[model samples]
Target: MQLHHSIGGTGFPILCLHGHPGSGGCMSVFSEHLSQRFRTIAPDLRGYGKSRVSGTFEMSDHLLDLESLLDRLGIDRTLVLGWSLGGILAMELALRSPWRVTGLILVATAARPRGSHPPISWQDNLFTGLAGVVNWVKPGCRWNIDTLGRRSLFRYLLGRQSPEAYRYIAREATPAYLRTSPTATRALRQALRAGYDRLGELETLTCPALVLAGERDRHITAASSRETAGRLPNAEFYCYPDTAHLLPWEISDRIRADIDRWLDAHPEVLRP
Candidate 1:
């Protein structure tokens, strides 16, 4: 199945994958920054964004879509940037097609995300209401709002930046969040609850990797992200304080700097 994607710039290729319930548009900030030095391909994996939601899909299916995408693009090898669920897909891709992935930048993700299913609370409903109201007042968002954003899941996507940064992120991300497919969201939730973990098959490929996490991330534990770096043959890891799952946006400057430094360390990422 063809996937909807956003492509920009022209340099080293970097495949950007967003988390579940998120669209390629959510990664636009990172893509914009990286596009100067790298070719970024951000895709709305199988069931989100403008991509029509077909029936439920499994991890392998996502992997296949990515592989096919790369093949169609005529890219023999590329750098990878994955966030949350997207990070899992990156790891799987590196393992499945070793030569295809030259490097990985993983954020707020774990090798085997604990299969703990969080129950809905009043907070979720409260945020849902807040999101609904945002849509109510915003003329552009009147008819488009997915009121299923659960607590930090929404804020996590929005990021815990300064008030100005928060508004900036929210203005751009709210619509992306609202466009999330309900069926896709439910499928991902159930998959997590069903304890769908393939940990034994996990291993970060030999390529250099940069694993980052937030000390305050409640969704994907920092320990797990650090452990992922440990298991990697060549990897660097960092965990920021006072940040949550939205490290990509919360400390986006830091992440961008780190990406630059890491690329310098692994010069192979820049060469053909």
Candidate 2:
């Protein structure tokens, strides 16, 4: 698979992996800011964006792809920032290949499948089901800005994305594999449902980690991020107030600053 990637800047590499239902292009929100200090490489994982899926889709498959990509690019070690589903993958990568990953930044994710959280409200479930139907029938449909209420909900769920960003997302963000391949879609859905259970494995990780969560994120509560941070021997935690799942877009500057400070504090791990 040829991972679609955006690469820029001149420093120790920071590989960014985006969340589910999104491609690496979604990281455009952070690209310009983080690129000033780090060589950020954001790749659309297998079955997302322009990346291809040769066989099964698993967290391990994504990890192997990342490792191969780094080796192919002559990068020995890198800092990793992964959001949502990507965060889980980042943790797995760090645990599986500790030497290759020097540091980690996990956002809107948990160390394991969130089992104890309350079930979704009926209204939320209805909306999600409707959205899934809409996605299936009219995948290219775009949301209108005139609908202020709906727009507000979108902003609440996804952060403050510009109108143009929404348009790009509606038109170009979805991968061909996701739209066309049933097997890939099924595998992805299954993976999202499977979640992670690596609290025990996290102890073996020598790399420092940062766990970030949005205060208003209902999907993954702030407590989950806190617990995830606690499980890691060398992990720090931060919460973004008034934000939801999309912290990178909602507070890119803050996220970048936190990462900058963290890197400065651990220069040995983020060597140029």
Candidate 3:
């Protein structure tokens, strides 16, 4: 598929996968930090960014693309960090090719589709309204993610509402949103809403994982995140209080530090 990717620094490899309506560039902040100690490989998932959109727009297609990318890079195995939609793909990759996955770091993701939930927070409700307006106007645009990244009205929707955090995310996330194709955005969203559950299968995944979510996240509720961590035999779940679904971007530093500690603590999951 000739996926466009960003690779920098040198050490152990860490393939970072981004979320919905976002390209590999969305994870640039996290990758920048990790690049100092690890070879950070971030790719624009098929259909997003500069990657070509060929064949079926399904999760299986992405999985194969990732495998091919690894082979092309001559990487036998490596740690993977997935955010949101990327998190789901990472779990699937671990299940499909356990030997190729050293460890997993899933952020702002859940094991299965969430059914009903409590009343939406005002911040999230406002976001939904704005998102609806953007989706209505552009149909497949990044749901106005560029504006969301820059505007303080939506800053509270993220984990950290500080000006520094907002600026940090705006720099990386805005480009990612701009790079995403409408076709890619629709395809991934459709796949996620298709009602497929892998809860039963998670019990068999033996590789260590770190499942992270935010307390104020409405996309994937905290309960779902906890259940996901509980289902996996070697998974650890952590929730940041008052944080929203944008944990990977909002709490990038903390997430990065936690990931470093996690990998160090689980040497068994490191590639030999």
Query: Highest lDDT among the candidates is held by which one?
Result: 3
Across 40-127, the per-residue lDDT of candidate 2 in tens digits comes to 8988777777775666665567787888888888998888888887888888888787888888888899876453334555665555
- For 130-163, candidate 3 gives per-residue lDDT tens digits of 6545544554344265554324235445655554
lDDT for 1 in candidate 1 is 72
lDDT by candidate, in order shown: 0.75, 0.71, 0.77
| lDDT score, candidate 2, position 202 | 78
lDDT, candidate 2, equals 0.71
**Using alpha carbons, what is the TM-score of model 3?**
0.83
TM-score against native, each model: 0.85, 0.79, 0.83
**Residue pairs whose backbone atoms clash in candidate 3:** none
Best by TM-score: 1
Model 1 lDDT, full chain set: 0.75
Using TM-score, rank the candidates from best to worst. 1, 3, 2
